[model samples]
Target chain A: MTGTGRETTRGAARERGSARWEARDGARRVTEGSPGGIVLEIAGLCVDYGDGPDAVHAVVDVDLAVHRGEVIGVAGESGSGKSTLAYAATRLLRPPGIITGGDAWFYPEAGEASSRLNLLDASAETLREIRWAELAIVFQSAMHALNPVLSVEVQLTDTLAAHRPEMSAAARRERAGELLEMVGINPDRLSSFPHELSGGMRQRVMIAMALALEPQVVIMDEPTTALDVVTQREILEQVIELRDRYGFSVIFITHDLSLLLELADTIAIMYAGRLVEVGPAKRLFRSPRHPYTLGLLSSFPPLHGEVRALSGIPGSPPDLRRVPSGCPFHPRCRFSLPRCGEERPQLVAVSADGERRVACLLHDGRQSPPAELGNPDAGSVPVAPMAAWGPDGPDRSLPPLDDTALSRPEEGVTPHA
Target chain B: MSYLGRRVGFYLVTIWAAITINFLIPRLMPGNPVQLLIARLQGQGTLSTRAIHALSVAFGLETHQSLVAQYWHYWVQLFHGNLGLSVTYYPSTVVNVIATALPWTLALVGISTVIAFVIGTGIGILAAWRRGSWLEAALPISTFFTAIPYFWLGLVAVAVFGVVLGWFPLSGGLGQGMAVAFNGTFISSALYHAALPAVTIVVTSMAGWMIGMRNMMVTTLGEDYVLVAQAKGLSERRVMMTYAARNAILPSIASFALSLSFVVSGAILVEIVFSYPGIGYVLFQAVQNEDYPLMEAIFLIITLAVLVANFVADLAYVFLDPRTRQEA
Candidate 1:
């Protein structure tokens, strides 16, 4: 991959600014790997479900950056807080799902300085102004998301009327028509009610409405989860195609790792509300450093390889209220080290270029004896090319630690946010 | 069938069923309309058997015919715009008696119901939008008012504002000394006497509408689409009114239509309580006097009123709810 690094990054940089599905003005161009490439940066983000002791710590301390025009997928099982992370970042979390800590900065591209608003710190008025105009969201369950009583045209025009109140009705209607067409829907269906359309059509309408304003960032939470495989693929293709045309970034969240692996530019695996690993899609799939990530990989059946008996990760997801101390995944970790139960791991670089990071004690050089072993590259995953790695590439048969040694929190990451 | 065709057919069948039931109720009574009329005539002079037979034929009482044949004749009479003569008011036709009282009921009940639906629904939207305020605070008290009988409210109004306060007349539709003409004095006096009963019906029915609307609004606020509307960056007022309340109002519109017909019967009780000379009071008199034809006419009119009102409501839904307009 290093041989074509320059070409790939340039391609990705162009991908960020091409989401111009609708005719829009004043859209600034962004180059990849530049300061302006980061569309949204969330730091020290912590979200709690309730107050005090009984509160469910949904999204614990985490930091993530979504580059302009990149499809960043968040994968996790139910209650893993992948959805919560998206909601918190967008400041869409309702009462009881409070953003206890976080500063999500919206970095407007060059020449669009006024839109650089902090999603969490903005006033209600500012948030309203910035919501659909600059940052829109495509919610899950389109059947429920689209207003049943409203016609598709009305739902589409509602956003335009709010953000562009000065536009003439004819122009608004024309724009809505174009949007439906952009999402592979017939413009004539604008007058149709939600119940009149199939589930896939409803989902497309939602996407059309979200793209109505040409927002810079769209956070889609399982937008295609309710759809069948063919419909899901069609919608996914439309999303990516629209993103490329309009240059808007996407925060695509779903538990379907295989889908993310195929669709996302970068995939982040969250476990028990904590991010366990983050890397480029293919890189992470071929080489998942975290035990939880490995378990998640094993759970999904490989489509293009020899069929293997699916081994779903043992045990249910931990209760958020009674989340275990230290590493949240220690109870479920198959290759658990005694130190994994006593200390939490912060995201640390594993690969030389620091393109990949993992939060597992095995990767912590400060606590691992493998670093001092005979082999110079002990405990580090071999940087094998994609073609060389099989679907189940990780060495999962390794023995559990018998050292029973405990260590302090490495990288100064506390047990809880 | 097409959607409109289906709906029209359904309504036609429903009307037939209602009219059949109305016809059956009068025929199934123990004594015939002719017998009641003969008893009234007995005081004047003992009638001979031949004279009684003529009276029975005059009242359209075909006693010797089978029930099915009588039912057929009743329909035939209805088609010719002939409702049998009143047993109580012997010379007057049922149509004439109802027509006389119908205007008074329409004036009193129609105006009062419109006022209640408007005020109640408006207050309900406001209360649900601003839930912790004084209007919402009064929900329980308002519910309590609606829970009481319609006449009880009328009686209470008469006691507090009529007999005790001396602000209005205690009973009757208008002043006894006022001449019955199309003059300003007669109209104003009639309105003055009706004020208490109208207030009673308005106060009670309005509370029910307001409570029902408030509950629906709360449920609508929880719908996912409402959240989506908010996410659209629309103003709070737009979200509340166009999105939340528009959908919330569907059930209310239907129920409001049904309630419009109910105002007539509700007026009956209020009219009796205050002796307001509307169709309600006239119907009460007919019932007390066993005026079979008059009683039958009033019930038929009420049923027609209910069916027509509901039919109109169903039509209104086709306009408001896009889901129902599908051809299927």
Candidate 2:
């Protein structure tokens, strides 16, 4: 709920930003009213895949508050459990992958006081009510998500019948036509089978279907990953514009940081089943605090500047079965300290802006001393600023990267210049 | 059109080669069919050279003629449907033998194969759609029947429904009292007597189709188009039948048509086992008697039937799948 208030303030700021820029040509006004701002509060979320030795702690002790009318991006490489967190939030994870712990509360604003529903603990009937009516999902592969034999009209109308049975057939058809137009599709193609449509158009149809019920939240798992660059941009732009127009929160999950930079309002960085940083997109993109977040951003090709050689993060994600002793990312961190191998750091507020939180030893406490260049043999390296350390420091046992370590050959590397 | 013309030319040459091979294999066998027929007619008595030479000429034997000359005569006779007279079955022409037997095999096997394919595919779609229900429960049962040897299943059907229940005739094409005519009463009686064996064939073959189709349907269910249909909010039933089943069933139809083409050959074993007087039973008699003329005629018909069946299957493929037509 605290995030909801923050989002409203952010919305007001966005409106002011829009008004100030409106005088310029082609500056369309982005209305602000806490319009699509719904609140999703998840607490003590835990997900485990089966029991005994085969079991996996896929998502552990996660908490997230997604505010409405904003695109919240969950970013991580494969095995970071980013997708698991998203699926868990919607209670969509199937068997063997059980939600061992958590409460996912949805606050849907329907004119009156918001209706609160806990997704994790709800009965099947209640879960069904939430699935398409309050929440919708756009899967990774849009082509795989459509039916090739059925016409688009039949596919669209099926969902309406399931969720809005009271609507007349004519009314449903009219609504479907309106939705197609809203999604920038030609309504005349409603009779066309999925195979007749292009990949991007199929994806657009998927998006239109998700919004058909006017759900409060739409979870898109790499929705445009399969699309071409131009189509991806158009689809994302249309989605963002639609979100603004209709007021629905979006949970965008992708490994594409550059794309997220342009679309998301907030970014939550996840690593090895835990959230390391959650902050405003601009803040996170400009100066990422977590070592993992820094590595992820650096890995991507820069979008708006002179070309630079891309740097991929060293090492694959740790095996979930045998996670590192202290910090899961300590083995790959460039600036790891001894303490990073001794004790796990909890997610706590960063001092630069208490609103932003990061879970790393480098940003733990208020007055922690700057780590000294403790290794006698190594030449002097500039210690990061005390303010840079913020409220956490790396666990002490992890050695900082030395010249020898940097010189070692690895896959996906170009030897840093 | 050119490609089709080339294919037809190729098929004609292939058939000719097959028939030539068929003629050579029997001719190379020890003991000539004509000598055996002559011995059986003459009671194994020592014959004079004059009588022996006379018999050979009557039977169209020609040692003095060149191999090419004999082959040319054979080809000319084949072209006119004069497959020569059967030496073992004296007085009967090869064409007459095949004509009497071909219809019985086609009717029994052809009709049964078609019925099995339709019923099996329907059940398969149902099984796939109603997974985890009783419909799916029938899959293992059908698969069990499918695995049972065809001859074994036929024997079992005959034993239980033929002898024990006395519901149908044990063998042959029709009831013993019924005359072998094309009249409705004869046709109905033949069908009635054929039911138990036909049912056995259908049950045994249907499993293959049902299992194959069900597996395909399951795979198609995972296709994106099916999910898109579901997402579009098409009713689950509509999505299952129209989207999932339609695409999945295409390959089954192709395989079915191909199988139907070969069904004539497959029925030989079943017909021989039951003494059903179909082409297979007649073919067995000819083979036992070393009746080369009758055997060649049957082989020619079967090869042509299979080739025609495959051609029809290809044409059906073009109709069922739009992608094929577009590619063509």
Candidate 3:
């Protein structure tokens, strides 16, 4: 038995080593015969926008794991490098915005075995094949993204023709109609031009297009930013409902923490291109460990909490061109210690849970209590009053109560809001 | 409805202003054309003061005449299709001289302008689509030709192709002994002689359209709708022609209309250099002999043509773009 245990340990180490090596070259590793839950694993990802002294580190030492049927929310203010992480993962980062290091592995679920594919090092042809097949994206500006001259039917059918050339014209049309219905849009409106649709309808059409291919992963970048509150709620509700029925993972990037808490299974908080803290949605919202995460939480009101003005984090995100030394977030961190300015903190597990990890000096040791996280005066950090917050506030009211809460699975409660 | 009515009313008032200015400008020039005509008719001898005054009154050239009376008489003469006699052309009426020359100028310059616009816009669209290719290689040559004066090109063409090679006629609307009649033979012969001058105009004017269309196409390619079209997986050719080319070509349409308005005036120097019996050649004779009525009639016709062209261009905006119709 001891010999068998040793052999298994050695085999596991070798597999891990191979995974690391594959990741270093920007490729995905497909592991076979593993319990099929995890769909994407991103490890040690670093992206730079330039070189030498002028280089901007857009994503630094970031790591995230998205499981099957789980919606992962990535929250950060603009320039905090949240969107860069998404772009880098998809290999869509253009020149001057380079992915210096990292591995984005996609594991497609198949019968009893899982197939892992490396995204970063894949051939252009392979990447093209995977695009809109296994993964898709919905950009923020729906009006600008949709061609004004094209009808909604053409826009949706176009993707099917490109990606699935074998499908007949009638089949493509039928699929498009089904997608529109799935996204809660009337089938009749498919023949209308983009200008004829409302902002919410346009965004829903974008969602339908992204979902048309039945992709395993969908990344949405501030999908509701251009919409009014009522429409925003309606669209988001439809998105959650579709995600539940489709059984696909999602990478939802937004600046609003409240919305993420309600929609995500796990949440990752980014500060200055670094993942400061990541945990289950409940734990991260209930008690965040990183100073930036704390600042982000206190800076906004909870949806279930009292109605009050929103507060905002002090200081702007550091200019990536000339980032501060050591921890990039140290300058803006209220709980920054002398060590924080001198040494960058590596992401470490907060407990033996393996589910929660944070990159902050305060969480350096595994045994540190949750209450002892960050500086003692971190809670009292000076933030602008909620009324003084800019247009991009995190404390907006909750989406309407009719939409089912797809992220919450522990409680048998049907979604009331 | 009210807004459209107001716009139409404004355009009518503008047309009226243009006509009034056209009528007033030639009369404002310092010259007693009636006295000059009387002196010439009297065998170049000095006319008596009473005879000169009587001739001035009869011609409605005296300052004592009411403005309304002079304008009414001018309108009557204009309406009757009479432009008086051209002093330079002996006893020929200005209208007759113009009538004899108009067709030659229209056939040559009008056809050249249309051909230039079509070829230039097509080449420009290709250049924009195939950027960094040999299609753009011809741009510098076109620019060089455009910069050279039309008259200089006419002289060169005549010298090389007519004088040296004897491939085309040197001067006149037809062969030297050809009869001047309105027949198929005469028209075809005139067209044969007009070829070299027409080529010069086409080559010179083509450059402006090419450069303008290319620049506009580049700008339109950068618009979001073009990018959206590309993202939709449309073929590169479809995207280029439908999304980029259509929008870029709009401004060229207005410019082409403006160019057409100038064709009737004709290129004076080119006509003189080739000795083509076009409107420009006739206008030159009028100017040299101080024939004010001929000059005024040509100027008035050219101005009215330009106004009508501009009105048509404005209407075209509604057809080419649906957004304009909505706003209007």
Best by DockQ: 1
Candidate 1 ranges with C-alpha deviation above 4 Å? A1-36, A110-115, A305-309, A348-355, A369-416, B41-54, B62-69, B126-135, B177-191
TM-score for candidate 3, please give it. 0.70
- Model 1: lDDT of residue A416: 36
Candidate 3, residue A295: Cα displacement in angstroms equals: 2.2
For candidate 1, what is the DockQ?
0.52
Error of 2 at A279 (Å): 2.7
What is candidate 3's CA lDDT for residue A81?
88
Model 2 chain B worst lDDT run, 10 consecutive residues: B319-328
Give interface RMSD for all predictions: 1.0, 3.8, 3.7
Rank list by lDDT = 1, 3, 2
Give the TM-score comparing model 1 with the true structure, all chains together: 0.85
Better of 1 and 2 by DockQ: 1
Runs in model 3 lying further than 4 Å from the true structure? A1-70, A84-137, A146-218, A245-250, A274-280, A306-312, A346-357, A366-417, B1-10, B32-66, B69-223, B248-253, B267-286
* Displacement of the residue A21 alpha carbon in candidate 1, Å: 10
The TM-score values for the models, in the order shown, are 0.85, 0.72, 0.70
Cα lDDT tens digits for candidate 2, A19-75: 432322224333653434446766657777887668788887676777766688998
Give the winner by DockQ: 2 or 3: 2
Query: True contacts preserved, each candidate?
Result: 0.66, 0.40, 0.17
